[model samples]
Target: MATSTLLLHPVRLRIVQSMLGHAQTTTRELAERLGDVAPATLYRHVAALVDGGVIEVVSETRVRGASERSLRLNLSRASVDPDDEALVDDERVRAGFLAYLASLASAFDDYLAAPRSTLEADLVGFRQVAVFATDDEWREVAATIRDALLPLIERSERPEGARRRILGTVSLPVD
Candidate 1:
């Protein structure tokens, strides 16, 4: 049972989060979406993800005379457990969590920067928050949230039109 926090360093976290829900991405696509991450730096992070078994090479295609590599995550095995808790305490994990969050923020910021008009309903994002009861309350709330979002993902696996690639992360805070 691998701990997600042990697996998710700042750079590795960004790469995994970005690659989630997408069909596949080449090293170049990842570098571009990640922003300001030099290819060498991004490649190192990507390699780490590959080594961790969080992300795996899915396809090879030719682009500009180069063999472009595509990678995707192994969803069934992707999770953080108590043993996966790499931090000494809540404070340390929070710091890494904040850094992990900022990368997600940057990804969305870059998305909004794309050439598109606000009239497009598909080109939008939103957030919601709720306070819970006991630790069990928090756990149930988290499970409910995952339930709500998972249908769309399962739908994407069916033979359908081109699926829209997206990334998602759920934060379940506990003390």
Candidate 2:
């Protein structure tokens, strides 16, 4: 399966997002995180990703007579390569992008609805700013942001007492 095609399905995308930044994960954990998805459906999609080479099983163990697997994403295989002919499908890309946005919105909604939810106290932020820059300057800005974030992005272990935080970014140019 083409990388884009494999990763773009809404459910698969959610799986990938849940796995991101984690060094290893199991289907049981994924089921807990994605409570709305049926366990069978989640397992099926996970199997597909494994078969497609997008995620690999790192180890397996028997727990209570059932084999449990630990898996991680193949980051190199998680992205849509420019050379992939599948990139020509604008509708596919659009649908996937919409799915991504929808997931973020849903996450935000859940956060807001939770008891004792306070945006300021939680350090939550949602804002947009327009930037004027030439192509080279824009590239520099993006590179700077990535460089600053690489350390945190590469960390797989969470700190003690640290809660999970979501940070999402989207860039669009309008002439």
Summarize candidate 1's per-residue lDDT along 69-130 as a digit string, tens digits.
88877776455655654555777677767767787787667777786667355546666675
Task: Give the per-residue lDDT digits (tens) of candidate 2, residues 3-85.
Answer: 88987799998888888778889878999889999989999999999999999999999999988899998888876686788
Candidate 1 overall Cα lDDT vs. reference?
0.70
Candidate 1: clashing pairs of residues = 3-84
Candidate lDDT values, in order: 0.70, 0.86
Deviation in Å, model 2, residue 106 alpha carbon: 2.2
How well does each candidate superpose onto the true structure, as a TM-score?
0.72, 0.89
**Which residue runs of candidate 2 sit more than 4 Å off their true CA positions?**
none
Name the weakest run of 10 consecutive residues (lDDT summed) in model 2.
156-165
Cα lDDT for residue 45, model 2? 94
Worst ten in a row by lDDT for model 1: 1-10
